[model samples]
Target: MVGDYDSYFADRARRGAETSPTSATTEPAKTAPAKPRNAPKSGLTYKETRELETLEKTIAETERKIADIETLFSDPEFYRTRAAEAAPLQKELESLKTGLDDAYARWGELEDKKSGS
Candidate 1:
């Protein structure tokens, strides 16, 4: 029955889906530690300080990636020759933007907690 299905229905599995376990040699990606910021206020705990710094770093990285994607989108030649490639990048750009918004919200919450302490 598998062979009888239409191509569209037969290929319903999403592209980029991982189908196998990664090899042992594939080390997990390591991000550099967030850059040092102005020392946290006296009221902030060490854990809170670390979390805020990491959030700031995440926000910065996400914004940079989003800008890079936007620049690519602005170049007409990119779309003209590689429109197929744009869909994945656009999806990634949207995800990054959403993450950035969440990061900003978390940062705000952290700030509020720091102030409340």
Candidate 2:
């Protein structure tokens, strides 16, 4: 399957190159991206930054969703709207709470390491 996919994309690329006028040029192709350095050289600085940012964004989004559900619950008319409607929200709330807890724990661990160093 992997080879098939590679070949499929390769075929498409060939087709595209044939269709493009620039394909006739003798100019060299663009260079590939630089190889990533080892963690010690970078000490996970870039990865940790990205991870914390993504986690914070996800946590904020989850909190917003939980707040939205809470707002729905506050509506006297929405009360007992149906178990089917509220059950999914309850499930999502539980999942988000767990994820937020995990993210905070990881963030704390990263901060501790950063400070200890």
Best model number under lDDT: 1
Off by more than 4 A, model 2: 1-44, 80-83
The candidate maximizing TM-score is 1
**lDDT (10s digit) by residue, model 1, range 2-114:** 55457656466432234324444588799999999996455568897899999999998989999999999999999999999999999999999899999999899888888
What tens-digit string does per-residue lDDT give for candidate 2 at 16-100? 9887887566587889999987655323487887887787788788789878888886777775565467778778778878887
Candidate lDDT values, in order = 0.84, 0.76
Off by over 4 Å in 1: 1-43
The true-versus-predicted C-alpha distance at residue 26 of model 2, in Å, is 72
lDDT for 40 (candidate 2)? 58
Which pairs of residues collide in model 1?
none
Q: Which ten residues in a row have the lowest lDDT in candidate 1?
A: 14-23
- The lDDT of model 1 is 0.84
TM match of model 2 to true structure: 0.55
Q: State the displacement of the C-alpha of residue 82, model 2, in Å, after optimal TM-score superposition.
A: 4.8
Q: State the TM-score for model 1.
A: 0.60
TM-score of each: 0.60, 0.55
